[model samples]
Target chain A: MQVFELIIGKLLPYATLVILIVGLLYRLNRWQRAAVGNIALYPSAATRWRLFGKVLSEVTLFSSFRQENQALWKRTWPFHVSLFLILLGHTRLITDWPLRVGLGLSEGTVNAISAWGGGICGVVALMTCLLLLARRFGIQRVREISTGEDYGVLILLLFILLTGNAMRFFTHYDIAEIQQYFRTLFSTAPTQVPHDPLVLLHFLMVQLLLIYFPFGKFLHVPGVFYSKTLLAKDY
Target chain B: MEGHVQVNETELQTVIDQVKAIKNGPRVLQLYMDICAHCGVCAEQCHVARTMPESRTNPAARSDHIRQLYKRYGSTWGQVLKAIGAARDITEDEVAVWQRDFYECSGCRRCAKFCPFGIDNSILTRKGRAVVHALGKSPFMMSETQRISDETGNDEGQTYAAFVEACRFLCEEVKDDWDIDVEIPIDRKGADILFIPASADLVSFPETHMGVAVFFKALEIHDGTTWTMASTAFDGANFGLFTGDDPHMARKNQAAYDACIDLGVKKLVIGECGHAYRIAKRMGPTASHFGNPFETTNIFLLADEYLQKGVLKFDKRKVDEIITYHDPCNFARSTNVFEEPRRLLSAMTDNFVEMTPNRTENWCCGGGGGLAVMDGAEKVEMIDGTFLDYRMKVGKMKVDQIMATGANYCAAPCANCKRQLMQLMEHYETGVKIGGVFDILGNAIVLEETKVKAGAKVAS
Candidate 1:
C-alpha cells in the first residue's frame, strides 16, 4: 500500500503533466493541419473581427445557449464559472506568496477569500454537474444525441468535484502540507508526498481526466479556433 | 432491421472510403468532425429539424451518421477499434438513410447561428453528398443537370441561336408594352459587364429577361455602362455546388467563367441567382479548377453601387403594390447580398414591410439546394409509405411567414427562392406574387433623367 501510494501520489502527477502537454500538442497540431476549407458560418468578412469577441462571450458566458436553451445554460454557465473559480482558488500551490499576496492582500483576507470562493464554487459545481447528469439521462433530445462518452464524462467530473469538496469541507486535511507536496511536484523530485487515501483517489481521477482531455469531447477547447463560421465572421 | 432496398456491398465500401478520405483537408472539416458536442441547440435553428424533430432529423444527429462512419474507418487504429467493438460499425442502413437526409438538407448553414461553437453541419452534409456522388447515387435532378451542364456548359442544353431568338422576342415585347426600346445585346464584344441569367429565364420566365433588358438598357442609356449577354455560356445556375463535387461544380461554372474571358468583359457580375453568386464568390476563385481573371460579385453589389451613385431611378407610383422581400438562404447566409435588394425594393414601393426574421435568420424557401429542380414526390416514398410534395411540406414555416407579412408581392432575388416562393404561394393559396428584384424594377423604374435624388433618398 505504501509503495502504491508513493508512486501514485508522487510520480503519477508528473506523468499526467507529460501526457497532458504532449497529448494536447499532438492533437492540436493534427487539427491545425487538417483545417483546410473556409466554412465561415457568417456570409461576410465585414464583421470578421467580431469573431473572437463572439467566441469570448460564448466561452465565458454560454451566451448563445443562454439565448436558445435557458434550461441547459442555467446549469452549464454556473458549472463552468465555478470550475474557473476553483482553478483560481488553487493558485496557493504555485504562487510565491500563497493566495496571491503579491497583489498585496493580507493573510486573513486571503484565507477568507479562499474559504468563501472555494467552498461556494465547489458546492455549486457539484450540484450543477449532478443536474447536468440528470438532464442527460432524462431529456429525450439530449439522450438521443448523447453517447456513453457524454454520461461517463459528466459522472467522472462529478466524482472529481465531490472528492475535492470532501477534502475542502469535511475532513481536517492539512492545507500547508498539500501545498508543500505540490511545491515539490514543480521541482525535479517531489518529497513528503501526501499518501492520504482520499488525496490519492482525487489525484488518480485527475490523471484519468487529463489523459482523456485531448481525445474526447473536451477537444472542443482546441477545436473552436478552427471554426469556419468564426473565420467568415472575422476574416 | 430487415431491409427492403437491396444494399450494394461494393458501392457501400466505396462510400465509406470517401467519407474516411480527407484530401489536403482544410482543418475546418477535421475540427468540425472532432469537436461537435452533439448538442441539440443547432436543431432549433434548422428548418428541417424544427419541422421534423425525429431521430435523425436533428442537425447534429444527421451529421453524426457521417461522422460515425469517418471515425469508424479513419485509420488502422480506428479499424482495430471497430473490430473490438470499441466503436460503432458503418452499416448499410445508416448509409442508405444518410442519402435521403443529406439530400433533404438544402446545405443552408443557418444552424451555425445558434451553435455555440459555430459548427457548420452543412460542410459535413456536403462531404456526405460528395461521397454519395462518387458512388453515382446523387439525386436524379442534380445528376441530370450536371450531365447537361458538362456537355453544353448550361443546365438546359440551350444553343446560341435559341438564346438570341429569345432575346429578340423580349426586345420587341418591351417596345410594344412600355414604348421602351431596350436592346438585349447578344455576344457583343468589348462589353463592360458579362450578364449571365439562368437559361430558363429566356424560355420559361421571359418576364425576367424583359426586366433585364429594361434595367441594363437604362444603365446603358443613363451612365454608358455597357452590359451584354454572351451567346454561349449563358446560364448562371451551377447544379455542381448542389452535388458537393468540386470537379462537377467546376464544370457547371466553367461556361460562365469561360464566357467572361471570351467576351473580354471588364466586370464579372453573377445576376440575381443565389447559388450561382455563392459558387462564383465563395468557392469559385480557388475551387473552380481554373481561376476567374476578375473578381466576381453579385448584381446586388453593382446595383447598390449604382443606387448610391444616383445612377438608378424608380417611379414609386408605378410600383403601387405592397412589397415584402424573401431572402434566399444562399444570399442571406452563404453570401452577404441581403440588404441591396431590399434597398432597391424600398426605393420603388411606399408600403415595404419585412418578414419576421429577415437577413441571415430568414427561413429557407424549401426549394433551395436544387430541391426546386428535384420535384421528387413521385420518385421517393416516405417511411410512412405516403407520397408528399416534399418542398411544400418542408417549406411550411416559410409559407406561414410569407402569409403573415400580407404583402402583395415577394421580391425574391435568387432564382431558386423565387421558384420555391411561387410554389409555396400556389400550394398555400396565399394570393402572393413572387418575382426577381429586377421584375419589381421593370414595373416601376422611371426612364426619365430628373428623379435621381428622390430615388436615392427613398432607397434608404
Candidate 2:
C-alpha cells in the first residue's frame, strides 16, 4: 500500500497538468478548424461583447432558468453552485495570500469551510449524477443522443466528489501535511511525503478526473460557453 | 378531367427512386431525424404560434408532427417498443392534415434564426410538403394555383392585354395624382429596367403599383419596361415556394426569364414582392429553369442607389405622420437589403421607428412564402389565423412600439407584408394605416422647384 501510494502521489499532479493543457489545446484546435468555414460575415466588436455578457450570465446565474421544470433546475443549480464554491475554497492550494487577505479566517475556520463545501459538493454531485442517469434512461430524446462516454463522465465525477467528501468529513485527513507536500513540490524540496491514505486516494481520484475530463462530454463545461457565444447568437 | 386522373406510377417511382438515391439521403434524413432539442425558442419566435395561440401550430410543432413519422419508423428502441400493429399505419387523415398544415406555412424560415440547435424546421416542412406532393395529396389551393400558373402566365388569370391595361391604369393614376404623364412602356426593347410587379399589386393592391409609377415619374428615368406575359409567369408570387414543388417552381421561373429574353431588356427589376425578389436575386440566376445566366439587378437595390445618388427627392411634409417599418423576412433575412429600405424611410419621414427584432431578426408578415395566395377556407384556422399568431405577437409588439411613438402609419416594402399588416392592425384595433415604403416616398417626393429645408421636422 505504501509503495502504491508513493508512486501515485508523485505522478498524479504532473499527469493532471499535462492532461488539462494538452487536451484543451487539441479540442480548441479541432473546433477552430470546424468553425472557420461557418463564420458570420460583418461581425462587430459590440456583438462580441454582447455574446461574452450572455455566456457570463448563463454560467454564473443560470439566467435562462425558468419555472417550467423547477425540479430539474433545482438539482442543476445546487450542483453548479456547490462546484463553484468548492473551486473557490481550493484557492489556498494555488495562493496563500488570497485566503489570508480575502477570507480573513482562522486555519480551523478555513479548513471547516473547505470540509463543509466539499460535503455539499459531494451531495449535489451525487444528485446531479442520479438526475442525469434518470434523464439518459428515462427521456427518449436524451437517451437517443447519449453515448457510453456520457455515462462514464457522470460516474467518474460522482466518484471524485464522493471520495473528496469522504476524505474531508469522515477520514479527517491532515490538511497541513497535504498542503506542505504540495508546497514542497512547487518549491522543488523533494521531501519524503507523509503517509495519509485518504489524501492519497483524493489525489488519485483528482488525477482520474483530469485524465477523463478532456476526452468526455465534461469538455462541455467550457464548451457550452464558447458555443453559446459563437454559434447560437449573431455574434 | 376523368381521363387525366390516371396515376403516373413511373413518375412516382422516379421521384421516390431519386429521393432514395440522393448522395447524402441517409445523412440528411438522420440529421433531420436527430437534431431537435425542443427548447421551444422556435415556437416563441414563430408568427404562427402568436397568430394561432390556441392550436399552437408553430414550425417547431410542425417539425415535431413530422418527426412522429420517423418515430413510427422504429428509428429508436422506445419508438419500436411503442410501435404495435395498428400504430404503424400512416392514415389518410394524417395525410390530409399534413397537406393542410404544410400548405398553410409560408416557408419564411424565421423559426431557424431562434432555434437552439440550428435545426431548420422550414426544410423539414418542405420535405413533408414534397412527400405530400409525391403522394398526389397536395391541397386543392396549391394544385389550383399551380394550374393557374401553368396555364395563364400569372397566378391571376390576367391576359397580356389586361397586363398592359393595368400598367396604363397605373400610369393614369400617376397622371391624376402627380399631374405627370409617365409612360409605363410595355415590351420596349433595350430598356434599362424590366419592372415585374406582383399580380396582387396590379389588381387588389393597386396603391402599391401606383406608388412605383409615381416614384418612376418623379425620378424622370424613362428607361423601364414591363412585360405583356399576364399568364402564369407574370405573377412573381411563386406558390411552389410554399408547396415545395421544384418542377412547378422551375416552370414558373422559366416563363418569366423567357419573356425577359424575348423582350431583350437589360435588367429584370422584380417589384415589391419579397419571395419574388428572393427568387430573382438568389434562385432564378442559379437554377437550370432560368436557362443560362442572364444579368439582372434587383429593383430594391436599384431604388436604393437612385435615392442615395440624389436622383429622387421626396418632400417630408407630404408624409408628415409617425410611421414604423416592418422588414419582410425574404427581403431582410434571405437577402441583405435591410439598411436600404430603412435609409429610404428615414429620408422620407422623420417619425420612422424600427419594430422590435428589426433587420435580420425581423418577424415574418405571415403572408410571404406563398401563404397569402393560398385560399383554402377550411385550412384558414391552421394557415392564416393560426400561422399568423407569432406574426400577430410581432405585430402586437410593433403596435406597442408604434403606440409609444404614436405612429399613424406602418410602411412595408413587400405587398404581402403590407396586406398582413393591414389585417393585424384591423384585428388588434390599432387604427394604423399600412402602405408600401414607396407609397410613403411617393407622397413625400419634393418637386425640383420646391425649397429644401436642411433639417425640417414634419409634425404629425
Candidate 3:
C-alpha cells in the first residue's frame, strides 16, 4: 500500500506531466512539419484577426456544430462549457486566484460556494458523460463509425467523473494537505500527499487521461484549432 | 466484381506504402487523419450517406479506410494501439473496397462544413483516390477522359482545327437561331481577356457558348473589353482533380497559363465550370505562377459587374419559365460564387426561386468530382459501378429538391452538374429544363443593336 501510494501519489504525477508536455509538443511539431497548401473553404475570414476570431468562436461555441445539429449541440455544448468551468474551478487545488480570494469572502463563505458550485459542476459533467456514452451506443450511425478507442475513452472519462463525484459528495478530503502536496510537487521538494484513496484514484485517472491525450482522440482539443484554421482562413 | 481490377501482393503493398507516406504529405490531410473524433456529424450531413445508408457510404466510415491503413503503417503509437483494434494491416479485399468506396464519394465537401473538427472527408477521399490511381485502378471513364485531355489538350478529344471549326459553326448557328452575329475570336493575340470553359460547353451545351460570345460582344461594344478563346488551352475541365492526379492537374493548368501569357491577356476568365475555376484560381499553379501575372475571374462575376453598371440590359420577360439555381459544390463551397449567379438570375427572370438549401450548404447535384462526365465502366479491368445508374440513384435527392421548388428551369452553371442533372431529370421524368445560368442570359440579354429583335421576341 505504501509503495502504491508512493508511485501513484508521488512519482507518477511528475513523470506523467513530463510525458504530457513532451507528447503534446511532439504531436504539434508533426502537424506543423506537414505541408499545408491554400486549401481554404470559400468565403473564409477576410483578415488575420477575423480568422483568429472565427477560430476562437468555433473553439468556444462549437458554432458550426450548433448550426448543423441542434439536438447533439444541446448535449455537447454544455458538456464542453461545464468541463471548461470545472477546470477553472479546479485552480483552487493549487493556489487560489486573486479573482476568487480577492473578493474578501469569509473562509466559511468560500467553502460553501466551493462545495455547492463544485458539486453542481461534478453532477453536470457526470450526467453529460453518461449521456455522451449513451449517444455513442444508442445512435446507429455513431455506433457504426465508433471504434473501441472511442468507447474506451468515454469509459475512462466516466470512471474519472465517478471518482470525482464520489470524492465531492461522499468522501472527505483535506484541502490544506492537498495544497501543500501540490506546492511541494511543483517546487521539486519532498512531498506529503493526501492519503484519501478516492482523491488518489481521481488524481491518478486524470494523469492517465493526460498521458493518453496526445496518442488518442483527445488530440481533438488542440487539433481543432489547426483543422478549423486550415479550412476557414481565407489566405 | 464485374469491373474490379486484378491485383497481386506487390500492387497491394505499393498502395499501403503510398498511404503510409501520406503522413509526410499535406498537413490538412495529416491533421484530419490524426484528429477525427468519429462523431458521425458528417454522416448526418452527407447526401450520399443519406441516400445510400450503408457503412461504406458514411463519410466517417469511408475516411476510416485510409485512416486505418495510416494508423497501421504510419505511427509508432498507432502500431501499439493496434492491440486495441485502433489500427490493422491492409488486405487485398480492403483495397478493393477502397476503390469502390473512395470513388463512390462525390468530393462535394458538405460533410466538412458541419464536422466538429472541421475534417474535410473530401480531402481524404481524394487521397484515397490518389493512392488507388497510383495502383492503376481508377474508374475507366475517369482514366480515359484524362488520357484524351492529355493527348488532345481537351477532355472531348477535339483537335485544334476541330475546335476552331466548332466555334465558327456555333457562331453561324447563333446567327441562324437568334439572329445575332457574335464572333468567337480564337487565338487572337493582345486580347484583354482569355476565356476558357469546359470543352463540353462548346459541343454539348452550345447555347451556353453562344451566350458568352454575345455577352463578350456586348462588353466589346460597351467598353472595348475584348476576350478571345485560346485554341491551345480551350478546355478548362480537368479530370486530374477528380482522379487526384496532382501532376496531371498542374500540367493541364500550365496550358491555360501559357495561353494567357502567349495572348498577353490582362485577365483569364473561366466560363461556367466550377472545379476548373477552383483549380485555376487557388489549387493549381495558375494561382501562383510567375507572381500571378494575369487575374483569374469567373464569367458570372464579370457579367454581374457589367449588368450592375448598366452596360448590359436584360429583357426579363424573355425567360418565361420559373427558375431555380443549383449551386455547384465547387462553386458555392469551393470558390465563393454563390451570390453572382443568383444576382444574374434575378436580373434575367422575375420568377426565380431558391431551393431549400442553397449556397454554401447546398447539396451536390450527385455528379461532383468528375462523376458526371463518366457514364459507367467503359473498359474492362476498371474498378467502378455502372456509374450512370449510380448517379441516377444518388441524384434522386436533387431531383426531389428541384421538384419541391416546382421550378420548370434549373440554372446549374457547372458542366458536370448540368450533365448529371439533365440525366437525373430525364431518368426521374421530372420534366425540368436543366441549363446554365448564362443560358438564360442568352435568351434574355437585349444587345444594343438587337433590342428590336429582343422586343419582338418578348412580344411574341
Q: Report the number of the highest-lDDT candidate.
A: 3
List candidate 3 stretches off by more than 4 Å: A101-106, A186-188, B1-7, B288-290, B378-385, B450-460
Go through the candidates in order and give each one's DockQ: 0.56, 0.05, 0.80
What CAPRI grade goes to candidate 3? high
* lDDT tens digits, residue span B1-460, model 3: 8659454788778877888887788788878778988888998888889888878788999998888878888887767777766787777576667778887899999988888898999998898888878878787888988999999999999988899899999888777877777788888999999999999999899889988988887787777688899999999999889989999999999999999999999999999999999999887777743477889888988998998898878998688999999999998888889888888899888999999888888999899998887776644233446888778888998999999998999999999999999999999998999999877887788888645454335324
What's each prediction's clash count? Answer: 12, 21, 0
lDDT of each residue in B192-264, candidate 2, tens digit only: 5567777878887777777776665544432322333223245777767667787887777777787677666
Best candidate (score: TM-score): 3
Worst ten in a row by lDDT for model 1 chain B: B378-387
Candidate 2 chain B, which ten residues in sequence have the lowest lDDT sum? B451-460
Task: Kindly report which residue stretches of model 1 are placed more than 4 angstroms away from their true locations once superposed.
Answer: A43-51, A97-99, A186-188, A233-235, B1-7, B75-87, B285-293, B377-388, B449-460
Model 1 lDDT on a 0 to 1 scale? 0.75
Give the DockQ of candidate 2: 0.05
lDDT of 3 by residue, A69-126 (tens): 9888888888888788778877877776677667877778878888988888888888
Question: Comparing candidate 1 with candidate 2, which one achieves the higher lDDT?
Answer: 1
> What part of the reference interface contacts, as a 0 to 1 fraction, does candidate 2 reproduce?
0.00
lDDT of 2 by residue, A19-126 (tens): 888987875654544422121211212465676776576667654433334555666667778777777766666566454666677777766766666677777777
lDDT of 1 by residue, B168-246 (tens): 8888887787666677777888889988777767776677678777887667767677888887768888887777888
